[model samples]
Target: MLIMGEVHTGLLRNLGELSETECREVLRLTSGEEPRTWQRPLLYAISPDVLTGVDCRLPSSSGARIRGTGTVSHRATIVGGRVLQGSSYTTLLRSDSDQRLPWSHYLAAPGVVEVYGRPRWQDMADGFVTPEPPMDVLNVGAISGRLMGAVQDSARLDRKTPFKTTRTRLRWLFERDDARGDGRPAMRLTLGRDTMRTLRFTGEPTTDVVAFCEDLALHDWLLTTLQTLIQRALIGTAAPAQIAARLSPAIDHLLHLWMPGARVEEPFLPFWEELERHPGFTRQWTSSVARIRDQITVNTLSLLSVTESRREADGDPSPRRGVPQDRTQSHSHPVRRRIFFRADQRSRRRS
Candidate 1:
């Protein structure tokens, strides 16, 4: 069995981090279903799972025609009351019959897509992981995006964010363990262009897998957003003041969000450790943050120096210069006195 999903991560549309109650209100995606909230490791809230009906072709790398019809499960979530995510997934299953079943049958088995014909698992996985799939293929990502859009458009949000950054998409596939208890889990993560990521893992599926993916997506977004901020700063090319201005948002909105695996289950920590070992996500983040702080310090000193120079040029009293002069001291001349007397005498004569 295969469970495929996608998560869309971005900054919440609010000036500052939201309160717990506000997060709940914002994430209430359905009418009767209440969103769940947790505050232990972090302030996290997720809406009730909703299903989207999908009837489309399942792409196969071997050019086999396979049709799948089912409902995709998805939900919206808020992390730290600052980051928003839309997560969606559907399990792939082989159908007992070749024809499409009634809507009731699909509704009964939520988040499970039944394939009409036999399809190679590897071929389907390859096709889905590909950068671009055919238009006719099943698209769980589109469902996730729509859910995110709905939440973003809600009246509960102020629609004002501290920074402007692109949202990241993470498409993941989880294949159930075939050996059951004997084999160890394995994971492979890949980065794609335009802030897209793909992860393929083979493991014993657990209830916390969705939450694990959400955590990964959130951190990935933080990394991507901070990198973009630094690049826009143009460090050596732009003025220190400009660079500092560009990096301020990252410092204010993103620096404290580097908690990798903070909300994931214990079993998933090894996967995060694996990522850190190779790409060293946290190491790069630390370096980027240090550079931002250093630049800000340099810019502060530069501004102070410029202010001091201006004061000196204007003859204002500097600590290095002599004592300040009193502006109240007056200089009187005979020509000024004569003109004042003449003006008074002329006014009196006219009256």
Candidate 2:
């Protein structure tokens, strides 16, 4: 069986992280289907799966016309009550009959798409990962996006995010691992344009694969967001103050969100470990955080120096640090009153 899916990841549309209870309410996608919650490594919640019906053309690498009809399973998830993700997937299989079946037949087998004609697995996978496909091709990503949008538009959210960032889409395909007898999974991740990603896995498909991909998508978003923050800082080109202001959002909202396998199951640990070994996700993240701190320190010292110089230039008494002065006790200068009287007399003469 060929499993295909997409995940959309983004910051929650709230000013601060939500509590566990609030997360449950926000993820309530449908009535009577309560969202599942977990609080071990982090506060996590997932909505019950929903189905989206699709009857469209299946993209093919060789441009073969193949029609598919079925429903896609979708769900919304919140990690750490901060990041929101919408995930959707369906299994592609060959139909026994060439003609389109009734809606009831597809509804009975949820998350399964039946292709009318025989199609090569590689060709279908290639078409999904391709940047542009035919207009009539099934779009699982769009289904996931709509689900995410519904959560963001919920009244439970205040729509006041601390930082402005874009959502990322990750498309994945999983097939049986024919080579390995040990049951270890092999995977490939590709970065694509416009904040899109593709993953191909050769392993036995399990129920946990969707959760693992969601976890992967969350971390990828954190990495991508922090990288964009640093790039916007423009360290040497922009002033220390400007750089600090540009990077402050990461410090306030994103730095603490670097946990890699926090919510992932045991079987997926190796995939996270392998990614760390190659690109060193944590290593790059640590370096970026340190750079932000260093720049903030410099910016702080510069601001203090400028303030001291201004006070000296004005010849004003240095205000006692951390001392709160009462407005009623403020002293009025006698010379300032005399100057005001003289100014008032000049205004009268001019009139």
Maximum-lDDT candidate? 2
Please provide, for model 1 over 1-351, each residue's C-alpha lDDT reduced to its tens digit, 9 standing for 90 to 100.
Answer: 678999999888889898899999998778887899988677889999999898888867776777898989999999888889999998888888788888999999998999887767878887888888888898888988998899999898889988789999999988776723445447778899778899887767876778888888898888898899999989987666667778999878788777898888888888889888878888888898999999887665554444444455589744434322222112123444344344334544754
Q: Which parts of model 2 are misplaced by more than 4 Å? A: 179-185, 303-351
Candidate 1: which pairs clash?
A: none
Clashing residue pairs in candidate 2 (N, C-alpha, C atoms within 3 angstroms):
none
Candidate 2 similarity to native, TM-score: 0.82
The TM-score leader among the candidates is 1
Model 1 compared with the native: what TM-score?
0.84
Q: Residue 160 of candidate 1: its Cα lDDT?
A: 94
Lowest lDDT block of 10, candidate 1: 323-332
